[model samples]
Target: MKFGVVVFPGSNCDQDMHDALQNDLNKEVQMLWHKDKDLSNFTTDDCIVLPGGFSYGDYLRCGAIARFSPMMQSVIEFANKGGKVLGVCNGFQILCESHLLPGVLMMNAHRQFVCKNAFIKSADGTPLKIPVAHGDGRFQADEKLLDELQVNNQIIYTYCDKNGNITPEANPNGAARNIAGIRNKAGNVFGMMPHPERATSSLLGNVDGVEVFKFLGLN
Candidate 1:
């Protein structure tokens, strides 16, 4: 499937996402501008990606401003129509702000920007070492929403240790239930805090990030 990476003002990781999807995964890719509202070139089978970055300089909250972008309007419609969308880091914040994904990305528990490798595991206990970089990456939701997410199997990934054990020490941002990533109930939209694109290259000494794409059915 084709991949379209949106470029919002101040977006720093758009190229990283493009390279990972095009060069590393050998997929067709297009750089979609935030102002462009057209998405006719793509289909429901294609995936739209919101890469990590400090959109709008992270003003008015991490992704608060970006949700109103022209491109995001089209993205929202696309996702509502069963189109696949993936958001990473700041992009994940946008998804939450747009109501595409549940929960909010709050400030890190330590109140410090975290930029380091973090371990996260899938529901089946499969572990992947991915890099996370953000000050407001902690995920929080009310008890009712948490139970709904659990019942719907919407929680996709949680913080874990190298041995694939979920633990408090492995939680980098103190996300609720150690959640590092999750999907919408429809399973077409995904949001995650880690920068999987950063680990997709062999030069990075880790290719575990590619697994994230695979999970999205992109590879």
Candidate 2:
């Protein structure tokens, strides 16, 4: 599988994602700058990451402004064509802002940015790495969207404890419905708040996150 990690001005994890995919997972990967409007040059199969970071200094509410980037237009088109896209952290915000996924990220319900290694769950048979860190991580949408997510099995992850059961206190950003990760209606596009790339290898301290790639059959 070929992996393209999108890079925006303030995207700190762009290289980290690239290293994890190329070095750890041994997949073909490259960094696609946000300015590059042509992504058709790199579409082979299954995997492109919007990576985590404060794009554009988080000036207009996380990914609100990033949705208009030159490259995202092409990205939207790519995803619509059935390519898999993974949006982590701010990238998740971008997915929501781009309307590729449902809902919006709000400041943590606590009204503060949060950074911690929290546990989350996958209701399906897909096993995943369990821990990740981030701020601005809460997910919220209306009842209708929530209903739609459930009906379609698009809710891929939820905050939970080591036992794999969700806990109210574990809701780090007070995400509605404990939403931690989501997939597009087609199930090919995925976005989450966790940094799976950072946790993929033991040298980085844990291999739990490798399954995010594996779940997509990349690993």
Pick by TM-score: which candidate is best? 1
- Overall local distance difference test of candidate 2: 0.82
Pairs clashing within candidate 1:
none
lDDT of each: 0.95, 0.82
Write model 2 residue lDDT over 92-203, tens digit each, in one string. 9999999999888888877876766777768864334455556677888889989999889889888876667677887888898888899988887888997787788888
Q: Give the TM-score comparing model 2 with the true structure, all chains together.
A: 0.94
The best candidate by lDDT is 1
Task: Give the worst 10-residue stretch by lDDT in candidate 2.
Answer: 125-134
Cα-based lDDT at residue 35, candidate 1: 97
Q: Model 1 Cα displacement at 173 (Å)?
A: 0.7
lDDT agreement of model 1 with the native: 0.95
lDDT of 1 by residue, 96-196 (tens): 99999999999999999999999988888588999999999999999999989989999989999999988899999899999999999999999999999
Q: What is candidate 2's CA lDDT for residue 19?
A: 85
